[model samples]
Target chain A: MSDHHEDLPPFCHPVSTKLLFGVFFGLIGLTILTVATSALGSALGMPPAFAFPLAMVIATMKAFLVCAFFMHMWWDKSFNVLAFLSSLLFVSLFIGMTMIDTGEYQPTIEAFDINNLANVEVSE
Target chain B: MAVADSHNTHDDHHDLYDHGEFIAHHFDSAEQQFDSGKLGIWLFLVTEVLFFSGLFVAYTLYRTNHPEVFEQAHVFLNKYLGGLNTIVLLFSSLTMALGVRAAQLGRNKNCSVYILITMVCATMFLGVKAVEYSHKWDMGILVRSAFDLTYTHPTPTTEIGKSLHISDYLVYLCVVPALLLAGFLVASVISKLVNKATLAKFMMAMTITVSGYFLGVVIGIIFMNATEGETGSTHASVIVEQPLMLMASTQDDHAADGDHEDGDHDHDKAAAGSSHDGEHADHEEHFGSHPADGGEASFDAHHPDPSTLSRDVGIFFSIYYCMTGLHAIHIIAGIIALAWVYWRCLLGHWRTDYFGPVDYVGLYWHLVDLIWIYLFPLLYLID
Candidate 1:
């Protein structure tokens, strides 16, 4: 095995400690950014729809830093990256379909909430 | 075939079988084994994503249908705690990555230290979650029947007596251990009597049986509690009120408006109707206002009656518990995996040529943190 070992490619990819620390701080910074954005968004009168997307964008950035640097997906093989990214594609599909379906009933839901409140008042 | 090609290129080299003990015999070379293992773990992580997508779908569907419910219920979640957990998990992800790097560089001691740090962070994350959960439980905000029971009972404002909380300890220290001891004793006797095993073998069987029993009990308790909040006899009731009363009300309201055929353009009418309902003034106080402009009101002193909001809010809690509870289970699993890797590192099992286990487990840990990255913002920071 030792003789053939020279034929094998190096298994360990040396990621610098500096780079690791950079990613570490980057993640922490982004976390604070996410929280800050939500608080500031609400304070600045950003609608929930806008705030939600803003927060999601920040979170996506954090996820990317962790995945690329901390998880070492950046240096890893393309196939591995492909494998993980595909899951996100499916997740979007799941969310999209559900949202589309739920949108169809939004009017009904709003009306129901209104009627329920009205009924509660009459009973009181 | 690749192995044969390499062999021909290196015909003057020494024996291939002498590579290292960690490399499995079937693999052509260590790189092949490592790449194969890396690919396998990535595939497993893919499955994990699909597994969790189901829950995310539920979250999206419910939030879309009942944005007000999420808006109201999420207020009860402490953003401070959620943020703290996010940082904790992120730090753990860092430590896990560092640990894998240490192992890859053959720095076993540093690797063990990093894994230990990762485990500590996992424990801390769970600790924060426990605080959040217990708070929710005490407030009668759990899922389904538990929420109903607690909502009705409305545990007094006074602190729970010490004795009332001892059941958890009883379950953990006494009940669990006693069950394990009994299992081990039975297994040892059976091994001796039926298999005619030696004393040492019997002891080994006993040990395995006991550990397995302990693990099963722990997992069972976690799963059971996750699905149904502590359903001891103390909280049990034969009465079964409608589980989805609020849901029914919403549906009825919608159906009633549907009959009128102007639901789509009746935003002002809906608002007027809710404002007219004197009983839901508190609800309207929040719901009637634009959430963005109501930022200051988010911290208002008014507390909605738990009973009145139980139906809609209960559904939110159900999703909250299921998502966070399942995430907590993954954290526990990650902790165990890290512990195993830490132990292996101490044993010098991983080195530059073979740190696959550490690498793979680190990937799993990062994924756990990744999920929480999204979870924190969605569940806690829903402005």
Candidate 2:
């Protein structure tokens, strides 16, 4: 058994630069897409709130292309992808909780009457 | 297509082949060494993600307090440039992946070439961003204390418009792009310069490009602040009245005039309350030593509603600088790391079993691109 053993062959060929350049131009194209769609979204009667989100969604697509193709996350280990995803989930949760708190916290504007000069504090 | 051919095995299985002095005596085979190396790299990358998380949290808290300020300030950013950079980064990432692939197949020459191309794309991305940022400086958009208050609130035609308090967004935007580009360029130039076999006159060109950006930003910031300081005075009344207009304009259509009446009533109540206080003071002072000093002319002569415009403006640009500025720092760091990897590759230092450092850093480079995707919309695409 020692005399006859099976082992993985050393990989000898790596990727080429041509494909990398293709990714580069692709990113440029996506940037153009982001600019065009964002402009169109603003002009197409959408509210700024909604329009901006939609534009972000398009940008995210471009980002995904870079991550998966250029960054080679698609070819990397599954664990790396998992690590990235979990971090994103945790960040989203943090943002969500803070936004909730901010939305609920009553602003102090109601406590002070603008006309009550005696109660007002001014800094020169 | 024979079974005998499929069962073929190599002779190098159990035999310890001593090839060089650097090989660790503890490792059994090259395959084990390679996989472990890659694993070690991924672990290090996890730490990097955690580090960046701190900055991201800061952004969320500030954004929540002043959504409108953040929104208005974001409009001042250049989405086209950011989007283009994102694309450039993504393409570089792809090239990086291909480079790794080529390495795995034992094509060292091909791997080095791919890395060089990736570096070029990164350079181009930075070049575009530099041009875009120069324009912003010309427009007086950096977040120093004396930036122009050109972005007036739409409704506050009477008072001041809503400005967010987050100050770091603009800084994040400018710094991140510049940093990423500079880091990559430096890494490339340094590695090439150190190699005596390939050293040439190219170092001078690289030095010029690096110094040019530094000088430009310093001058731009100084000039912008000076101009703004000279003509920086804003009308306070506008700040106080803009919110009221926004509130009036956004009310239900059927109750539009009703809301307007209510708002006018509130304004009158505010005025009446002020005058009432002034009168009350006059009466109360009759019993005091300063009774004869009850002349209300001094108080009433210059009563302008304390403008919140400055506060709003300050808040808006603050977040603007923080968010974009933080992101910019990350970009610069990523560029430096990428450049380092390219340098190693150029020196023929990496082999199929030890490119994990390059691979993981590329992972991070992609994240910088991802963040830009979100920022471009949040800042530049505002309607």
Candidate 3:
């Protein structure tokens, strides 16, 4: 309904078909990368444990593709990006705290018998 | 019916109630309230991810000490089924994103179509998973007794198509958790039915119940496959001497022979037993265990060995369950949101100017599908 639609930024308009096509191919490329990395790791004798990280890295890349384009994160308000990033930050904190709590060590302590010190003088 | 404007008597309408000015005496605009709700949702999702992360980390430590167990277990998962689920979820994500786009553009008809497509894809993913799980169950693959391990389908050598790729140990770990998830989903559905909830609740309950029954059948088949003497649905015991059965097969000859010298066999058995204990202690020891193993064994059993396994394994299953369960939960939530949106859409509450809630829900739905895209491959496919 506006007379000067040309004055508005491109992002404010509908996304271009080329960009949609790019997303499609990018998704395919990412999937290939995920499979390739996983196969490479396994072929190199990496265990099942390594497969997860490889898969995760691949997943992160694929998710980035969807988020940046399909989800329109690239064109979203900076505030929205900040909000989403905050969630991720909290997630990191959660993982870190769990690791720390689970990783704590309880060392064994023994009482020294000083009453027999004369018979066995402490030798360093 | 014959109401009159009372203010007209004195013509003092300036003292009228300002409905617009009433802001519940709390927040600013409606947008601020909505933004706060979104923030709350994000915070909740973060906590959810964190909770699953703990499980992942625990799995990682266990895998480190039991590399063989992890490797052997990995084979039990059906990569093909997982890949199919991945593709299904990826497509669902696309549909969900399009649905959100449709809502943002105020195209309610298009939004509905896209959402329907998304729901279909989700259903398909669950369906394929059901088939694969059933195959495992029919094979007697669910981890219950160690006796299940001794039974192997002879076709793995001749017919490559029917090869049992999954390891016995992994079946217990992965399939058991999967069954637990199925049970939870069913429980959620039953709880909804008990509440005598709305139409959206009924639809969701129907979906989960059907899926749950399928899952239970699949699990039952896997248990059946493990039994030797019985047919498809029967549980008749296959009469065979336990020790002799283990011995006749050269595969487990080492288990029966125990022929190593006193020191070496003792060391090997101890090492194998200790590593197995460290990784899988959570399942058995967490419940109950006799105080027979030495002090070190008992101590390590009580304290999960997080230091030993690859951190990613724990992270994988952690994300696996969280992503899948969260997505399933969201599917149900989306149905409820859709029901509300349906009411609003029917009422013409949305137009070209304001359709943010519908659009945002669609965005969240896309996210749910997106997470599953990764989960399928990480859990089911990649060896």
Among these predictions, the greatest TM-score belongs to 1
By summed lDDT, which 10 consecutive residues of candidate 1 chain B come out lowest? Answer: B235-244
Per-residue lDDT tens digits for candidate 1, residues A1-124, read 2223443246567577789889989989988888888879877988998889888898999989988988888889998899889999999998897777655543433334333545634544
The residue-by-residue lDDT of candidate 3 on A1-124, one tens digit each, is 1213242222233344457557756776767667666668767877756777767877787878877777677876667667766766765666566556643432310121223323333431
Q: What are the per-model DockQ values?
A: 0.38, 0.29, 0.19
With candidate 2 superimposed using the best TM-score fit, by how many Å does residue B173's alpha carbon deviate from the native? 15
Tens digits of lDDT, candidate 3, B1-383: 22233212122321222112212225443334335544555545455445545545544444443333344344545454455456656766666666555554556666666665665565555545544543444444443221122233323222322344433332443454356446646665676767844444434533553454334334433533443233321211221221111111112333323322112223432234333533443433221232221122212323323221222122233334444555566665765565455445434444332345665665565566565655556455545
Off by over 4 Å in 2: A1-29, A107-109, A112-124, B1-67, B105-113, B120-140, B144-147, B150-195, B198-306
| Segments of candidate 3 deviating more than 4 angstroms | A1-25, A44-54, A100-124, B1-40, B64-67, B136-327, B335-349, B381-383
Q: Please, what is the TM-score per model? A: 0.66, 0.60, 0.56
State chain A's TM-score for model 2: 0.70
| Rank order (by lDDT, best first) | 1, 2, 3
CAPRI classification of candidate 3 = incorrect
Q: List lDDT for all candidates, in order.
A: 0.64, 0.49, 0.46
Query: Highest DockQ among the candidates is held by which one?
Result: 1
By descending DockQ, how would the candidates be arranged? 1, 2, 3
What is model 1's native contact fraction?
Answer: 0.71
Q: Which CAPRI tier for candidate 1?
A: acceptable
